[model samples]
Target chain A: MNNMEKIQELRHFLARYDLPQDRPPLTLGHPQADAVLGGGLRPGVLHEVFAGNWSAGGFAVALAILAAGTKPLFWVRPDYEAMEYGAVSPNGLLELGGDPRRLIVVRTRNAADALSASADILGCPHAGAVLLEIGGMPKCLNLVAGRRLAFAANESGVTVVMLREGAQAEPSAALTRWQVSSAPSRADDDDWGNPVFDAALVRHRAGGLGHFLMQWNPEHAVFTTHPGAVVAAPAHRPAYPQERRAV
Target chain B: MPRLPTDRLIRRNGAPSKAPLVVSGKSGNALHVHALEARAARLGLYKGQPLANARAMVQPLAIVPADEKADAALLEAIADWCDRFTPLVSLDAPDGLFLDITGAAHLFGGEAAMLAHVTGLIAKQGFAVRGAIAGTSLAAHALARFAPAIVPAGGEAAAIAPLPITALECDDKTLRALRHAGLKTVGMVAERLHSELSERLGKSFVTRLRVMLGAEEQPLTPRRALPDLMAERHFAEPVVTQDAIAAALLGLAQALSEILEREGRGARLLEAVFFRADGKVERIAIKTGEPLRDPKIIMRLLNQKLDALADPLDPGFGFDLVRLEALLAEETRPATISFDHDENARRQIGFLVDRLSVRFGYTRVQRFVPQDTHIPEAASAAVPAQDRDFGPETWTLKRCPDDPPRRPLRLLQKPENIEAGFPLAPDGPPKFFRWRQCQHDVARAEGPERVAMEWWRNPGLTRDYFRVETKAGQRFWIYRDGLHVQDQLAPRWYLQGVFA
Candidate 1:
């Protein structure tokens, strides 16, 4: 068989052994990004967002997705993340359109504990969305853990966002994976303009990869698109060359 | 009962039948006897004597290591058993138990009969017990340990006169000083002038003497709260099965519910105390989220608690008395429910939370309550789920629909320090910030929402917070501590929380 045929056969085998990914999609409110994703972001399935250079952009996107639903959000974070980076600023998120009152924060000691809590939160139907934030992809979050999260999210129909910091795009059971970075906000009379996000669809199960420049309009509580803008390369880049990542 | 360290371990394995048993603790270079069994006492081997010397005096002696925890647990169990006689049972540890029979004694015929019944019950369990009844706990304690088996009413002073002054439960130093002062017995100590005794032994010695002489009655502080209402059932034959216990609990709960209904009250906390025939006692307590009067719910909760115990309630031969008491109760009136299903669902959630908390511990199951505070970490407090009704007032973040909120959905427990590069002005948001070794250039910056320290609660540096979005879309709530006021310390920046 040709390479394409062999790959198709592998996908069929994986579909049977692994959890089902068919679920209603959640719109990210960006047309181009949604079109590339075949529909929109799928709910009841795990989705990973890598914080490329800037982690806040990825986290903002996660919150933006969560703000779509009115149910309570359970955010499980590694304790070290609070120590290393910073904790969630309730005031900032509130201003960003996510209700601080409906958020339940669960802090675990490590990435493994965070993942476990994420799986537990996904099983609760009352949790509108479950966000698990970790510094990097720990070894414990293997294929098995990913499948378990997918299964739980599917059963409870809760959107699960796995926010990873300084993490490369890796293959997993996640319905789609994206890389997000902060973009220059569109200028206005006000000093600090609308929050713009440079988001790229790095991986998708159904296969179309695309990028979109998104801006958060707090007045309407929705994302407005900026026509075709990618994140500018960092001025002072890392000493080591960036390694090619697997989709 | 204050046991010499050694007595605890030996008591658990049952009393040493033949050999003289002595509990020993290490003293200086050799093992010293801390407590002596009756046989050892009879053999003239007293407590605090070295083991080598004790062994030299007695040929065959049984020894065990000291265990205070096991002794305390045993004391608690025995106290539970005594609850069958009177709800007022408190620990007189390391070896004694105080049972305030008072008005309860008449139910068992009289005080003498009640004492005999208790002694008989303990004796049946293979334990040697010396019990006494008096108007006060102090008199009863002294009489039980140092004087006769029973002190007659209004004859407490005369009855305890012959007992040695050492029966005052004083330290060895005081005992030695009392002996040196030629006060050999209770009678001798009582004869001395109060001023003279207080001058030499301090005021406590005079107070102790007064309490023991029945001059100043000492009240008994019951270990468990005196139940608001109680109902108990005595079996003609001891019950050894779990089913029997459940039936007894249900019966008691129903009877207690009737009494509670008359007063328009419901039980918040209920305890089922089981007194075993073998003198062992097992207690199961249930706490409800709201006041409850339903006998069915009470019985179900008790059963759940009993089943959830790691060390299952052992009938230990058999239980003869099952007493159910409402340790805590609250006023209640029938509420008219708009929808029965909603009320039922709410009750079901409460019951599920209570059961889970009881099984896995309350700390593991928690709920958050918002507080009025600007210090991000102090905005919300997590409390045990069961304590949700501890206060009547509920707090939510106050924000107008049209106005933007200043708090994030999730706040970090502790603010983290980060390195950043900013303008020389030292007042505005940073142009670039480095957090967790990742640098982010400013793409968007918002105002410095200054949150002054709660000086009334805690004095702290005034913080100027800025909502800054890094070049990569990462939003951070960074704050510069201290103000730009002249003569103020240089303000340091900290990453308080994230926007997402």
Candidate 2:
């Protein structure tokens, strides 16, 4: 309202760009997925992955590894996730080329607790990435909670990947939305191969959407896009086919 | 504290009646007086007296039932309240406390002022109080019973000499024997030779006498561990508002940090004690991953814990005293410079872990540490992040180079049973299986990998494991109960975990 206060506000606005949180996008290494993502998945924002089983859970982990790099990755899950879907194994993570030593797991009692814990985890700039796995559609995960999480993530510049299982897509403040599931591996009968994903970029705030059948190379821990397998879909609406089970 | 049972009752309700009150309990088959108020003791009534005889001697007697449990709890509560005076307060059983104020007397001016302050406050709460200060606990215990006076150094003998021999508080048999030996006063008992006293009263009694005479010293066993460092604030008027409580805590934290800085040490476990004006106490504790000395960080963790408390801290009538104590401490480690911001980031992560642990629980926030073993389930264990004693962990990949992950990403604590049958071969992997009410047709399969149990472990069943991929693309690692033997019972199948 006054000239001096206006000048101070302009100075505060000018100071924010100097922060190191404004960095380049992290490439997912998949040509099709990266191009649709406008180069790649951007850091310092909220990303949501919707799926029914551990197949999508694994993909969420792969994205977390990309965002986290060599830093600590905190995975917060409600206790119901373990009871129904099984516990998250350290050996499984080690096999997937993620550092188990740099991982911290917080198993909260319910979705409310998981959300609060993730908020705290995201506030800490030291943590490179935080994965929050919520089970059912609890009332606590409303738009306000989503907006609060997004604000915290933006303030600290830590990437947050939320794995929502067994719930319908709801409106939120996430930057990108994904629908992922497991796809058959490209190996013969006697050889069980690497993890393959049917990842659909349903919602992108800054770019268009695309669906790619990607296979993960666990030895290198990156996605390898298969050429000529783009599924025909529209981006104006939420992606993924109707009549899908549960999620 | 002498009539604690009666005092507790009288404190709960005002004095019930004009008649003297005695707490009675069952001794043998008859009711006997267990404890009595001062008014009752002044009459012919005394402890251990049968009710029938007491009622026959005095008219209009009042009797109350004895509750040992309530009495002990009250004593413990009083001991907790006494923690404000000294951290080394120990219970002296049924009705007394021993305060080891070896170097703490100066805070209350001197021994005389502290004694007067403690007894005066306790008496203000409507409990009869008597206290004394001496060179040793035994001397103090004896003097407080007969005469409430402070005994100076090297005056232990003269101070207790003129008192009756009962002041020594020896056994009744020993007192009767001492009286029979023409020793009515402690001075008369002290006149005998050491050998004569030991021969008559026994060696333990003589040692007790020596301890009482201040010729020997004994250490007091405190009821709780003594804090490494402590700082407290005493309010002239009790504080009830949130702003006042916060200000008090900030002050105490600053004081504690100053002390810590002078000693070049930091605290690992910090506790806050709130002594309420209504004689109730509340304690809150927080633990850290590393030795922390910063006041701001300490207050932040405390605030986080306070917010996450199941029932928020209530200022019942307001707190009269607030004390901050470091229950555990360690020497501060100098920060090491790294090529990147790794060191600073690690410290920040540690603080975050501490905050989350306080909000959730210590066991809920954990890091995976690789164990040195061959067993699948025992390969890694989640240790609480607050404790750094687990040491370094280097994960060794179970799979060979360029091969698919042999281990499942998420291992269940225990395996669940599933129905499977119709393998390509008798010992081959199952063709199809039913799990969680869904039937999955196996398109690709690998295994019959036999894993025998170690000899040192419990004789668990040796399992033949398999990794099967369902036609829908979900991969599962399942195992058969035992080996394929001739004429053995049919082996059951179990689903262990799923591949990510």
lDDT of 2 by residue, B452-487 (tens): 877687567888988888876778899988887757
Model 2: runs farther than 4 Å from truth? A1-22, A226-238, A241-247, B27-30, B161-203, B334-340, B389-391
- Write model 1 residue lDDT over A124-162, tens digit each, in one string: 565578777877768988878887898888887887888
* Error at B466, model 1, angstroms: 4.1
Question: Residue A156 error for model 2, in Å?
Answer: 1.9
Expressed as tens digits, the lDDT of each residue in B337-394 for candidate 1 is 6467545544554665565455445554455666778766677666666767323434
Per-prediction DockQ: 0.19, 0.61
iRMS for model 2? 1.6
